[model samples]
Target: MSNLNKLDFSALEVFGRNYLKWVQDVKLHLIVKNLHPAIEDKMDNLVGEAKKANAMIFIRRHIHDALQTEYLANEDPRALWVALVDRFDHQKDIFLLEARHDWQYLCFQDVKSVNEYNSKVC
Candidate 1:
C-alpha cells in the first residue's frame, strides 16, 4: 500500500488568507499520521521527542517558506501550532467583517446566477 498522503489543498500562505481552512487541513493531516496528540491540549503524555519532530516536519512542509523561516526556532510542534494560531486566528474576524460588509451591499440583480450569489453569501 502507498504510504504517501495526498495534499488535497495548497500550503498555508504567508498572508493567511486561508488560515481557517489551513488549520482544518493540518488537523486532518496530523490525525491521519497519528501525530495530533503533539498539538492537542494537556500535552503531558502521548508525545515523545521523535513524534514531536515528525509532527513538526509535517507542519513545516505544509506552510509557506516565509512561515517556515519565521518559526524556525520552534522545535516543538505544540509550540509552533500555538504560535501560528495566535498570529493568524484574528484573520477569521477580519474575514467575517469583510463578508458582512459585502453582504449588506449585495444586490440580486448584480449577480449573474443564484449559485454565484449564494457562493458569495456563504
Candidate 2:
C-alpha cells in the first residue's frame, strides 16, 4: 500500500465516476486494496468527528476467503437525514446526503474508477 500522501489524485477521480456507475448497477462485493495506514486513520478520525456532531456511524466489514476487508461505501441520504432529525438515531456518523455529495465531489476530483476511488479513499 502506498502512503496516503502519495495517492494519485487523477486515478481517484476516475474511480469516483465509475463507483457511481457500479452502485447504479448494483455490483456487490466491490474489492479495493493497497490503502495507506494514514488514510484508514483519517477515516477513523472522520467517524469520531461525526459522532461528536451527533451523527451516527455505520461500519461494515467483510470477511471472505479468510481475509477481512473494509471500506466506506455509499450511504442512503434520506435515511441519514431522518436519523439526523430524530437526534437519536444510532447511525449518525455515516455521511449524510450533503456530506456524501461533498465527498463525491472531492473524490471525483481525484480518482478515475470506482475501484481506484475505493482504494485511494480507503
Candidate 3:
C-alpha cells in the first residue's frame, strides 16, 4: 500500500460534501510544506514548476477519484485551486444561510428588548 493512501483527514468528495473541512486541510498541508504559493500565486518559470507539481499531488491525493478525473485538464495548481473554490465555496454560503435561520429563531436578544419595553409601560 502507498503512504499517500493514509490521510489525516477524509478525502474530498466528488460532490464536495466534505469540502469545507477538506479545503482547510489542504491549505494547512500546503502551508506546512511551503507549497501554498502554488495555489495562491503566479509563479516564475523555475521554482514555480516544482512547487506547483508537489502542491498538485497533495491536493489531488486528498480528493476523490471522480474529482481527479473532473479536473484532469487543470495542470496548474493555482487554476485547479480556483476551480475547486468556485465550485464548492458556495456551499458555505448556503450553509451559512441555513444556520442563520436556525440561530435567528434560537436567539433571545430580542426577548430582552421586549421585556424592557413592557417594564417601562407597566
Candidate 4:
C-alpha cells in the first residue's frame, strides 16, 4: 500500500466504488457517520487520521481544492464523500439520457439481421 500512488477519484462509479471499498477496508467508514457523542469523542483522533488519509488519496487538483474549501472546512470525511456523490450522480443521469437517445436512434440498417435488430430494439 505504501508503494501505491495517490488514488484518483473522479466521482465516477468505478473510482467512487473502489474508494468506498478502500475506506471500509481501512476501518474509517465510522468517521463519516453520525454517531453518539461518547463514541465520537473516543474516535476523534481516528477521524483526523482518516481525514488526512482521505485527503492524500485525492490526487486531482480540482478535487483537492474542493476538499480544502468544502471537506476540510467541515472537518468531516462524510462531507467530502457526500459532495463527491452529489457531483458525480449527475453522470448517471447523463448515461441514462445517452442510452435513451441511442435506443431512440437505433437503425435497422446498422444490424446484420432482422432477428438481431429485433433483439436490440426489444
Top candidate, metric lDDT: 1
Cα lDDT tens digits, model 2, 8-95, are 2222122233333223222122213211121222434333333322211211121111111212222432233232234423223443
Error of 3 at 74 (Å): 1.0
Superposed Cα RMSD, model 1: 6.5
CA-lDDT, candidates in order = 0.88, 0.32, 0.85, 0.46
Task: List, residue by residue over 33-107, the lDDT tens digit for candidate 4.
Answer: 322121232435454455444443442222435345545554444454455556554656666798888875677
Clashes of 3: 0
Which regions of candidate 1 deviate over 4 angstroms?
1-8, 107-122
In candidate 4, which residue ranges exceed 4 Å CA deviation?
1-67, 70-72, 103-106, 109-122
Best by TM-score: 3
TM-score of each candidate structure, all chains considered together: 0.74, 0.19, 0.80, 0.39
* Runs with alpha carbons beyond 4 Å of true place in candidate 2: 1-96
For model 1, how many clashes? 0
- Which wins on lDDT, candidate 2 or candidate 3? 3
Error of 3 at 101 (Å): 0.5
Q: How does model 2 score by TM-score?
A: 0.19
Give lDDT: candidate 2, residue 3: 62
> Cα RMSD (Å) per model?
6.5, 20.2, 4.0, 8.4
Candidate order, TM-score descending? 3, 1, 4, 2
Q: Mind giving the per-residue lDDT tens digits that candidate 3 earns over 1-122? A: 77657886798998998899999999998889999878875446345688989999988888899989999999988899999999999999999999999886655445567676567557
Give the TM-score (vs. native) of candidate 3. Answer: 0.80
